[model samples]
Target: MVSWLGHIRRISLTPGANQALLRKRGFPERDLHAKTSLEMAGGSFIEGFGVAAQSSTAAEATVTLARIDGIRRGFAFEGAAMAMAIRDALPLGHRRHVSDLLEAADDHIYMIHVGVGWSFARLPRPLRRAAAAGLTDPTLTWLALDGYGFHQAFFHTDKYVKRQYIDPDPPVPTNHHPEYAPHAIDQGIGRALWFVAGADPNRAVRLIEAFAPRRHEDLFAGLGLAATYAGGAPPEELAELAERAGRHRAALAQGSVFAAEARARAHIAQPHTETAVRAITGLRVTEAAAIATQSRPSGHTVDGQVAFEVWRRRIMRRWATDDTAADGAGAPSTSRQPSTSRQPDTDGVKDGS
Candidate 1:
């Protein structure tokens, strides 16, 4: 009986399939194949969200999530995380649905945490902190903001991408390290450009270049992750992306390594993942994944630096110093320096431009 109520809630709250349609979303139709691929991924996310919302147990949801093969499976897990997060935030008697799902689907932890960010975008402002409070990982929880940033860019391209808007103050829970939120969100927006540009590497590059130079590193990092993980570009295009990364090559490689690790951890095998890894970092998937694993921080902030950024810097440093495939010609001195600007905010629904 309780499961039935869950299903009812899903049916009422989930957006219609049309919402994922590229035409409806007003995204460019640069490549028919890429457009179709992203739209399908979006559909799979909706399907996974509904399945989790309706499931009586995390095990029940895992069964359905496992059946979703290939890269789409990660998106499904992300959607499931969003559903579990929403459930955790509600006044319902059941708690720890997110924790239980993580235990069963540990491989998808990256996607799952990002999915929780989607829940933050959907929930009322007051409930946002409650959702953040439920998540325990200090470093991984920041990925939620990345997810939130992606949601905003994908849904509001005009403002987030075209207008080059940045939230002056994102409403992140105080405990979630609101200071570094914008960088994470920019990473997500950068990732969204892959889809927004219809997987056209050239277009994606142009989009990132339009942003402020300081923002370029994080944006490029996001693009690398999307190009590697979502994988719409062919090998040549991947090479083009790396070349265009220019001074931010280390940042791009860092993001690609992170994506490679996420896919490897989830046991997801995709040709695009390999192609992007090779083109961006000139390393095999295993090699790139190893770098990501080796550089992971202990999840403790040091001198006000978030563990997540620390981990990213470690990866960037490795690529900067050790990566033979990367051209050191114009690499930035640092991946991301501290911004003197005031902290930013994102509502995920607003056209804050």
Candidate 2:
């Protein structure tokens, strides 16, 4: 475990630090070209494990694996062996569960240094903070995916000056990659938070609340993921943070469960899975997975991803309906809202870009 933490630390540092860590882990290469955040992370991890090939396709596979691991780290919280080892680790709570969003944000910043150099990194800190604070429980479900999509578009900008917001409705990419021309609605709001709050959680939430009520879910969810993952909110303050965004405590808990389940099934090592899931949701892995299976949308098989979404909606529907009624809130109508739907394989949430 100590050795693994060391490996993560090296990768989370500068690009040169990543190269050095790979060598220490017994890889032959002293350096490699990883031109994006995902690639830098994936490449460092894959190269350390001695699995990367010479082809671009092989590198992409490594990047995907690294991303899966990163999300798992977010879910694992203090249980994340590597993140816990960091000296400056920051903790954030989401109702029943706790996570280290600071570490997650550091991972992002580290990637920026590798892919876009110092200038780009200098400009994104505020945007990243606002995005984190602007999110809510329901919106978080999809905006987390939107962040992935945003990363794809953001990575393509070789120059910081080239960075521009894709309008709310973007033209579909020829390759059909959702992240390519990210739908600015979800991704746009998340990204805009940077200008509003920078890294200040308090300011971020205020900005998030200023959005129209119809957009509250998306804004709140995006803020939750970003704040919990990157904005450095203290654990004790999480409940207040949610309250400020006008999110119900129960809804926050449910969204976290979804985030946790999404992260867990992505990785093979289950060292922390049972403990983390039980701690957050009070259910063992097998029991939780079974519950997920029962909740599957009609006509959809109960895979990890499908089950995760199903359980998320089941928990969320209870709170959203109650909250909307109690406050006379005009949350998005039930008809078009994916959270209210039973389409087992809905992409509304997980479609990152």
Candidate 3:
């Protein structure tokens, strides 16, 4: 079991504001040798660079605990109380938690923020009108994990990946994980969104709502890069995906037919045309369909005035605004990490830089 360390700072501003907030708030102004997108704790550091660590799901969170006995930083594992607190906090850093947080905090300023990014309900009337007029890219995908790491360098360690798993082709070891590297995919998406949102609420919301569930054809498809080749996705799902992509592209070309265009826009527009949603999720579309058939589920209602994605982005933007209102609460220090710590991590398990 590997020791796991997670960072959970609540920045009041988008990434850019991190520096100013940091300095104003009197946090240490450390400079990094290079600018990095995401920062890891004890779990993914190697040498002085970040290499192998990737964001993962709730289920995979235990992997750090599983492989490593009790976590040891320098020397001691966190006391029971501190460990429990960290465990409870891990999911927030791990997943792009939306629905649940928004629903729970609907009356709060954060919820209000979450709703405005892509939604007219929470949007400024002008932005809503512009969005209505089709003056925006409804669906934009920012690559995560390796994608985010391309530019900056900070605390993440590991300059080289010490281990590589040669994935088995399709129908992995179990139905639970029929794909090659399921956790890897989730980790990538989770890491990317978390990192991007840290700096840009506008882009973060779009990436989350429009492209987050990228593993789902009904979502964004750039996720295919993380696909683990679970059993092949349904052929019908594949066909439907193609149709959606074609229709989506066409809708975009047809001008500001907002709703129509979104419907046409393929939610899971995979980065790799060859990948499928099921590959990322592990479960088959049949499972989703079956669940739907079994339950006499009622469709949740929403104000149809705005696209779901738009509403979500608007909401996140508002949260960013609110965080900034009283001065950013958890913004990262835009200042650099101390130059004294530029070396890569030597541990092969945590960092691969």
Candidate 4:
């Protein structure tokens, strides 16, 4: 039997299915395939939240999540993670709910961490850290911030995307290494741009290009992940995205590798994943996944940098090296450095607040 609290949370927190509709989100209908793909992801997210909110146990919720097949299954697990985190953070709620779900859905750990970020976006300021308290994986916990960025960009399109507002004071844990928070959040915003542009490669490129040049690396990384993981674009479109990435191509390829690893780890396979991986990274899904795993940093931090960023840089460097060698350049550089050119600030773009 569902508790009164659970029932109330279900009704209050779960968004109506229509909320996932392109028209509802004010996103353009670029292509039928992209629209359907994004809407399906949104719907899966809602379903996951509903199932978790109403289920009595984490195991019960896991069974329901497992039934959601295809790549959409990952999104459902993400939603379920969000719901569990929210429940655990609420007053009088079970503190172990999020951790319990984590234990049950071990394979979806990455998506689950990202899902916890959704709770941060939904909860009151005081409860945000509480929601994150259960995450023990030091390296993966940063994904929650990525999720927070996605939530803000998806829900507050104008402020986060159009205006390109950066949070002056992000609501993160006191000791959560606040310095790298914006980059992680920007990665999420970049991912949201994939949905916002309706998976149109040209549109997505234009959106990322609108940001400051410095932000392009992380944004492109996010876009690569979305393009590969969510996969609405065709081979040609994927190729176009890769070409448009230019200097940030390495970042884009790195993100694709990350996405490939995430899907491979979760045991979910789709044709789009293969197409996107091949088009963007020139590697099979397995090859890209292997690269990501092999390049992963052993420690949570490396040389005073977040291991996650270090891991990403390592992947980017590998692509950079390969690209140089393929271009007949004598020796490959150690890294792909960001361009130093300044870009005109968009109308409403603000540093913070």
Task: Return the TM-score for candidate 1, rounded to 2 decimals.
Answer: 0.88
Local accuracy by lDDT, each model: 0.79, 0.33, 0.22, 0.81
Candidate 4 lDDT, 1-353, residue by residue in tens = 77886688789878799988989999988878999899988999989999898788788899989998867999999999899888888786578878898899898888998899999888888888778888887777788888999999999999998888899888664364567788889989999999999999899999988887778878998999999999888988887777778778877888898899999998996889988887787777887888788877755567666777777777776665544322222223332322323221111122321
Tens digits of per-residue lDDT, candidate 3, 1-353, equal 32243222211111232322323322222333101211221122221011112213322322232233211110001111112222223334422222222232222211112112222222334433321221112221111111212111111211111111122331111122122123222223322332333323233234434432332221222222111111122334432332333312111111111111121221222222122322222223333223222321112212321122233233222222222211221223211111223221111111111
Instruction: Assess every candidate by TM-score.
Output: 0.88, 0.39, 0.19, 0.89
On lDDT, the stronger of 3 and 4 is 4
What's the alpha carbon RMSD for model 4? 5.4
Model 4 bad stretches (over 4 Å): 1-5, 173-176, 322-353
Candidate 4: residue 136 Cα off by (Å): 0.9
Off by over 4 Å in 2: 1-145, 148-168, 171-188, 191-199, 229-231, 247-254, 267-312, 318-353
Candidate 2 Cα lDDT to native: 0.33
Note each model's CA RMSD in angstroms: 6.0, 15.8, 23.2, 5.4
Q: Which portions of model 3 miss their true places by more than 4 Å?
A: 1-44, 47-184, 197-199, 209-353
- What C-alpha lDDT, on a 0 to 100 scale, does residue 106 get in candidate 2? 35
Residue range 124-205, candidate 2, lDDT tens digits:
4433322223222222223233433333333332221023333454322122233423332333344334223433446656
